[model samples]
Target: MSNSVEYQQSGSVAVITLNDLPVNSLGLDLRTRLLELFRSAVADSSVTSILITGTGRMFCAGADISEFDNGKALTSPLIPEVFNEIDACPKPVVAGVNGAALGGGLELALACDYRYAHPDAKLGLPEVNLGIIPGAGGTQRLPRVTNLKVAMDVILTGKPIKAGKAERLGIVDRIATGSDFLTGAIEYTRVQTVSKNSSDQIVDFKGNDRSHLEDMLKSLHPVREQSKLACAKALDIACTHNLEDGLKMEWALFKECHESPQSRALQHLFFAQRQATKVPGLEKTTLPRAIKSVAVIGAGLMGGGIAMNFANAGIPVKMLEVKKPALEKGLASIQSVYESAVRKEKMSHSQAEMCNSLISGTLDYQDLADVDLVIEAVFESMDVKRQVFSRLDEVCKPGCILASNTSTLDLNEIAAVTKRPQDVVGLHFFSPAHIMKLLEIVRGKETSNEALATALQVSRLIGKQPVVVGVCYGFVGNRMVAPYSREAFRMVLEGAAPEQVDQVLTEFGMAMGVISMGDMAGIDVGCAAAEANADEWKGDPSYQALQFKLKELGRLGQKTGHGVYIYQGREKINDPETITLSVELAEKHNIERREIGQDEIRKRCMYALINEGARVLEEGIANRSSDIDLIYTNGYGFPSWRGGPMQYADEIGLARVVAGLNHYRESLGEYGELWFKPAPLLERLAKEGKSFKDFQP
Candidate 1:
């Protein structure tokens, strides 16, 4: 029996159990054992039918994503090879799914002759969420099991389909009812093997596009055939393109995403996000307390949205705002979001009402005395947050975990004002907390394990994925963005118009470009952060120049109808006036302008962030690479496909990236801050021909 997987003959049946815990992941070890098991099962005369099931609750979650960053995996073709062997097995193979079967898990099951799923099991191919196409047999096998339309949807969106839906789609043979999933599957297997059905007989799957999708392809546009969103209008893209062509299209699209600055930035963000939680040397432990009731101080956008998550999770909450008007506004905002969810069919009207009923808005801090946790979503100002935390220190219960939703602030300083620093933590929520999935759980220097546990548990209860991080000025996500933005602005100075820079990025598969993002976030926000950093980092001259000039001119982005570009309502109206103004400012500062290509803009913008992330890792801001990826993927819309920035660095090859950085450094001669120098860890890794991927964190 191998450590990752094992198979044993029990009379005529080979019982194949995946030994990986929690969820049996298709890592290098599992793939090796699975292959060995399949070989013995196929060759042994005593074995007739093979029954595969996971040891734990899950059949298989997917591949070992963490292994993607592991250095030894630079060239491994095990999962695909194992899947091929499973598909080519001479005897009938049965998959007994005890829990989830996702991505490669679902791909492996699809290759089997029949699949029996537990009632609670979910099955799907969700590789798209990570910004990569399923490199496994998903693109090939899914269409064979179900209609091409459904396969396209599953492959593109990566949404998990329940067992019932999987059965309806003909992806599974039957749904077993018993709590003992293996017993139910074995009984079915016994009945099937006893029948006259031939061992070599292949299972039949009817694809919806089998008949006419070929003809449908002649009339479709290239973009419609290529873009995932465009598939909505045309209906059957797989019908038009051959299976090989479709796979190529997927790879091409994935490559486009890979080349994107947004993808690059997002990948960096994903890794950075995962690193957010490693409080240096803090012991990871479970606490006895569970958050049943929550007190949200400051019923503003973040507070109200966070309250919705709690109520939706069946937790009762008391929402505290400063005044009656503020309370009413917060409640109304909550109601509006619920109504939107109802319209989208995300939640039932009754469910919405139940969630709404769980939240009570009031003005008094005393109402939070008995709450299990209190999260303050106060204004970004340190003085304001400090005052709110001080008040919470006086009123909340001794055991109640105190948290701040402030995106950027020193959690330690805020905790210092409290009676118990160990009880204070930072649980930073992305905007529209109810809608977004990522929660940044920041632990200050004195925060206890119990406090961290409460925050992490509460995050799950609210239907949010929480990645904990250590405290910094802007925490993990925001701090990393500084370098990326600096280079984006640098592109503007280098004679690439905002739209051209944006176009290249968007074409590369980003939702939008840096300029559009800046416009969306508002220039004032960046200007303000830069101003704060200018004073905070102490005579940071480069940041000071942009901050002081932008604020002095009152050029505040969308809210002011102008900043980098003018806007009318929601549509952006780029006035040549902006370009002229920008150039004038550059000239006034005597900064020379030169032509820059799309590639140059992207490299500078993205690599800048990755370089900064290396320092964060070395400084112990993040525990592991996975935590950083979890943050960016969940909170910042960092594309999951490239595996986060540090992962991307590995993919890009750090030695190659380091060479590019030094080249850029020479290019920027005078203006280059010695801070642009690579981190010691990064320098060592590059010299050794290693990548950021070498460090799991």
Candidate 2:
């Protein structure tokens, strides 16, 4: 009654404005007000057409997340009622979409007879990423409004379609110019609203003849069915209601998702993702320098991947490799990845070629001057990396942001050689940088806030999620990884075989278990990291035996056709000689071998990683729990459905986890103290019944 919804009558049209703050979400109060506004328009005899829009940057961000984020049971009779009420409105209700019309917001627009979008608007139904289908009439009305395939595509993938694409798809009636979006919608309603004198058609599908669409289906069996079934289910769920009955069906599904265990996890994940970027020192963090062009030093796997990421971001890259053959191979690898995307239909041939043209290879240091940023992705050796940074400091522009793609090197040492130490930052791009969604923005002590923000923006441009991290050994990923690997070693010392361990973990939703993952990543790398730590753990005879035995054998990994398991054509056909050596070495030290249960195996691997993650948070290495989750989910293939380890910890209860860590702390003693002891941050939060969100970045 107090104007939660406001009416601005402009001549022949009645404009209903939703003025709720912060993206104008359609929550319970807004829903009630929406009903009142529709009734007001209906009652006014002068109102011929209705133009509904929002008084914010976005039309709406869908339902209020506050309603469900706290593990609430979703009750029925939800969004469907609202949608049906819109459909039942006798007058033409036109929607003026501006900015993001996502989730239930898009569904609200669909309830209108026609939709008008601004040039910069984005439309999407992103429920699937949260582990729920479109519960609102999205499933039903979308297919009827567009073709079956187009509806399925929008629902399944959850990617936003541009205003131009939406108009072409007939999802929007028209695309408006840079004027008041509502004015165009009102004009459209004048032409479209039907009276007794003018009969109106209830159809708006006007898409191109996609008759050849079926031929694009996958030729492969399981992959074809996997794609087809996923698409079909998206539409099938939508067909449960007609336009008038839409609201009921939509609310029912929405409620199902609201009460789902998956939804609970996703809500935690959403909060975690928000936390991920919040590391301390953001107040002083400078944006990265504008990266229009980049120079990459080294053409090895990491360097090539860095170049490819820049190319994909539409930044011109001059890749400088020391040797001719190395440069050729790096460029070839970039081509191969792009070619694979085309073959898989992830990209068009033209688009792939465009991305490829952006990367250039050379052997000259003179090529570095014009670039805004120069990232050295050479060997992991400290001296080599320091030399590269020194050269970049001399040759590149004074303002050029310098970066090292080192997973474990010190950013301070790298920056010490550069004249402009503030410009130096660590851009730890995971393997196959272009494909990975994470780019760790590790700030050195002198790195400014503008540089940090610039790095965050550039990361978004390059299609990556950036998490600004504090400078430390191993940064965040490898730092936490050390404890996770320690647990893996402890698992081996116990009676569980590598295959058994892998099976238990794979079942937990990882793509591969720890042992198989080691083989896939090359055991030589892990052994190298361990050997570097040999002196630190010298007093512990057990660790020295495990490290030297692996180095003694030629069982490096799949690259050498042996590691944790022997490989034949991507198949592990034989048990590894290194594993037998490890077992023998353990027995010789009189280390007791008791068969560890599957639950313990899973807990040791996951909890160790999670415990270290908390430690990283306490030490200010990572900004937020969500940032770590983003790194793991996108970079390390941690299953999105379960959320990241931080989210999983919240779901499983931090109190329970703390107790488990305490158990390990007592039994495993000193080695356990290094990896098994839960962080004080974790202990406090658990005891207080709080969450990772309780901490500041």
Candidate 3:
């Protein structure tokens, strides 16, 4: 037998162990070997029962994801065949779920006559997360063992449940008693007292339950369009047919989803997220500095949120402000957040209290002297940031990682003001930092590997996805946002209504419309940021004219109840006043108020960002195209199903994106000429008949 699978006999029980390390992924070789061992054990008359378990923490993650890119996933003795053989076996087979049994792993367990899991084990079919449903007997067998509600919840959400919950839901037959899961599983096979029907023998569901299941699936508001397909098919297989027919149908449905553009995109993101973690030139053996305690400069909203992230991770934090009033306000804000979380049951009372206790407020910079790290989340001003960093350089202890949370300033310039330039990095956390998952780790020119490693480590500890980026204005996420948001505002000035512009984007899978997003994020805030960098857009005086006009009119956004749209309670009604203002500005600026098509709006806005993303890649600001996608999907509300903008551009074909940009450049006249020109990298790739995926960077 192959080393992937090990077979041993203990008395009348035959034990088969999955020896694949990391995660016992059912690759071609592993699947082939396991089948051989199973057949051999069945042929031996001395083996009365079989016990299958994995070596370590993971029973199995699932099928080999890498194999899917090639035709190896569809090779002979596929995952389904292994499950079919196990299901058809005459001898009783038991699965020992010692750890997480996800996706095809759970399907494997379902094929067994009985399953025993350690109390800490996690089990679920998370194929929906990858834009597919379980392809084996998962849909059929899961509904057979558990109710429709449990099966729907488990399959649709793609979230793993604890072993105790699995036992209650009837997904797992019994919870293993001892810490040694394999020993308990072997003993279970030997003493076989409880007589239970195999998964195939159990009926799908009661007559009345099918309608309820259908309603439940209908009520599901999945963000991804492909999830609707996967969910509907999973429900049909569960409620419509027997195991034999269902498995065949499941494979066909799985194939359909696997071949879809959305599936390919989702799979790309899964691999892209993992690849983003690896920093070039930073060895895997590099040791990160231990961050025992942290300090936050400025106790504003961003600083408070940043402190909460460290505190939530069980690290002590000191928040410093210039005055006691501001510090008190920040502390109160943190307390309110924790209190709300506790009320919503999002955090346990004890956990919330512990987190709150970890955050301490002070007014003196000297109080932060002993902190291992200092993050300056002050105003987005160069002079202000430099002053904070200069002071931090004097107060912070040796080797303390000095970080600036500046969203748009130059990190290298900020580092130059500090004595320890090598220790300075940028931890650009998104708004409500503790909640947002994305963290842009900006590596300054003089930043050491130790600083970068520590930032990555800190990101993991705080449950944030870190993407290391080269120092640049706005870094990766915010830098790309400029062109995307610019196009959104410019389109509105060109005659598209606020709602119309937003509706087009939402229909195309964006979480929210750009015009509405501007309203909600406060227009004045954006105007301020734009004015701060006024020197960059001096050539185009009419740039963001409507936005500046609104700011001048004291229409600030949701906070003021009137910006681009009039807010009435939670609903935003189209304000004729803003439209009238936009028309006046358009006429004054010699811009025509022509009707804008949805398709044009989408292409212009999306391709603008894609073009900027290509420029980011060409400039080496982003290591890979997928890293940009990761930032947008996590930080910004770019649809995960479409992949990132870069992936979307690849799928639509780079040639097509270039054509759109060129078309808009000529169609919009001066406006397009100013903003719609495709990046050189993008043009080169399109001319070469390649995609962003083909780009070396």
Pick the lDDT winner: 3
Candidate 3's residue-wise lDDT over 1-697, tens digit each?
A: 4699898999999999998998999999999999999999989999888888898899988899787773544887999999888888888888988899999999899888898998888998888888887887787778787777678778877899999999988889899988677888999988763334344465456656777766755775554657655666666765667677777888887888888787888999999989998988888888899999999998988999999999988999999999999999999999999999999999999999999999999988899999999999988888999899999999888999999898888899999998899999999999878899999999999999999999999999999999999977678887787778888888778898878889999988888988888887788878876786677677677788888999999999998999998888898888988788888888888888899999988988899899999999999999999999999999888999989899999989999999999999998787778888899999999999998888886
Per-model TM-score versus the true fold: 0.81, 0.86, 0.97
TM-score of 2: 0.86
Query: What's every prediction's RMSD, in angstroms?
Result: 5.5, 5.1, 1.8
Q: Compare candidates 1 and 3 on lDDT and give the better one.
A: 3
Q: Please name the candidate that would achieve the greatest TM-score relative to the true structure.
A: 3
Task: Give residue 598's lDDT in candidate 1 (0 to 100).
Answer: 78
Candidate 1 residue lDDT tens string, 318-393: 9998899999999998899889889999999999989999999889888888998888897788899889989989
Q: Flag regions of model 3 displaced more than 4 Å.
A: 70-73, 193-200, 203-209, 217-223
Q: How far is 668's C-alpha from truth in model 1 (Å)?
A: 3.7
- Sliding window of 10 residues with minimal summed lDDT for model 1: 194-203
Model 2 per-residue lDDT at 432: 71
Model 1 bad stretches (over 4 Å): 1-20, 24-54, 62-93, 127-142, 178-183, 193-280, 490-496, 504-510, 536-554, 624-630, 655-669, 673-675, 695-697
Q: Which residue window of length 10 is worst by lDDT in model 3?
A: 193-202
Query: For model 1, what is the error of residue 574's alpha carbon versus the real structure, in angstroms, after optimal superposition?
Result: 0.7
Q: 1 or 2, which is superior by TM-score?
A: 2
lDDT of 2: 0.74
